[model samples]
Target: MLYLTIDETNTLIREARTDAFHLEVSDDHSAVADETEPMRRVLAGLPPFEAGAYPDSWREWDELVSELTNRGVTMRRVRVVSEPLTDYLRFLHGLTDRNARLGEDIRWLPRHLVDQADYTTDEWWLIDNAEVAFTIFGTDGDFVGAALTEDPTIVDRCVRVRDALWSKATPHAVYSPSGWSG
Candidate 1:
């Protein structure tokens, strides 16, 4: 029942010992302004974001992922997106290569392929399989805060969901957004 600010969540992820799993169930996260500028540039027909480019927030994340990977910690993310893609998802798809290159194993899953009843609707991060941090978003799809718990029941469920979805999702390198429209 403990709540964490975004910075605290980032610290938790950075301190993960062996594994960190992120399950992104939403298609839009407009409140995360870190990528706002990059998204704007791309949407306006400009070049996509580069690793060290604008929005220092991304650079911070890139460094964290790189450091975690160097420490042999596995970081994985599964994004469950509905098609045709939302503009935000499309924006994310374009920027995923940087994440992959930085050592995160990112995957894309078509929402239709999943049985929603089996998973929590909220987005979450399973840190080293010992704790779960559920992301709380406002009605407008803006992230508000995170609820972190170490309860075995909830953590176990997240582990199961992560394993099941990871197996079915397509790796970022192989996924194609060709048929989808924003």
Candidate 2:
């Protein structure tokens, strides 16, 4: 199933969510170019973060993670990146601790540190360790939607790949894009 809009994709993700939801994020500078954040800030009347004040009030993020984690749902993610980190990645770094505090375990793996052949290059979600949703991005780095599937083989492969990457990736707290090592 292909979700053509963000709302449709969000709905599918929320509905399909189970006890444990894992994510693998490997993207370009999508977040910085994303239209949602600016609109979200406007709706909340929040000022643009200078360095993204950590523990900053992103109500939706706080509420969702708070709700899910309180319900004992496990959320974890591994992000693979090519260094030097993109501007969006550097920006995202400041907000990750908020996620860690909310019970999500996020790890970062410099692309040079991993075997390129072992993992998928694009961003994806392995929901409940049961389904695979491959994100589609436009040339401008805006998210278009996703190709979602529940094929057993695809699910199995994602699980395996996620495991391999998650094991080697550095925890977000310990990884500094500026301090990347070969």
Candidate 3:
């Protein structure tokens, strides 16, 4: 169970050979402080800009995803969200189309559809089916560090869970976050 900094986790994702799968179960992740302005704009009913004109933060991620896609590394994410979307999730929803266009396969699963006890509460990244990096968050959902493991037991279990959730989630292109009243 080795601990990793955010940079280290990003490095792991960048180095993935075949696939990078992420599972996010939190409704609000305080780690995304950089997105505050963008989120505020979204919640305020502002329209998004052209992808080429997006903010630097978003462009940086787009570049990474494009690079990975060029390298033939498949990237996928499944977010388990509660209804009446939180501002954070709504922000993410606003950005999902761009993310999908950048080569990430993003999906959303409504919380009501799954048993809470069936999944791990932590967010995690499974790199190439070999390593599982579980994100540690503070009680307030602030970013802590990450626990990374290559232990087959942990990695295999995460793979199973990811697959199960992925199969059940709706693809981002078709899923509307209609629950967001704001």
Task: Compare the candidates by TM-score and give the number of the best one.
Answer: 1
**What digit string (tens of lDDT, one per residue) describes model 2 on residues 115-135?**
765687667777787777787
* Model 3 Cα lDDT, one tens digit per residue, 27-137: 987356566666777778886553455677566678889999889999999999998788789888887888888889999999888765457777899999999999877
What's the ranking of the predictions by TM-score, best on top? Answer: 1, 3, 2
Model 3 Cα shift for residue 72 (angstroms): 1.0
> Which of candidates 1 and 3 is the stronger one according to TM-score?
1
Estimated TM-score per prediction?
A: 0.91, 0.75, 0.87
Candidate 3: C-alpha lDDT: 0.83
lDDT of each: 0.86, 0.67, 0.83
Instruction: TM-score winner between 1 and 2, please give it.
Output: 1
Worst lDDT 10-window in candidate 1:
49-58
lDDT of 1 by residue, 68-151 (tens): 999999999999988878878888988889899989999999988997755678899999999999997667656667899999
Reference-based TM-score, model 2: 0.75
The best candidate by lDDT is 1
* Ranking of all candidate structures by their lDDT, best first: 1, 3, 2
The reply for model 3, stretches above 4 Å from the true place, is: 47-57, 115-118, 138-141
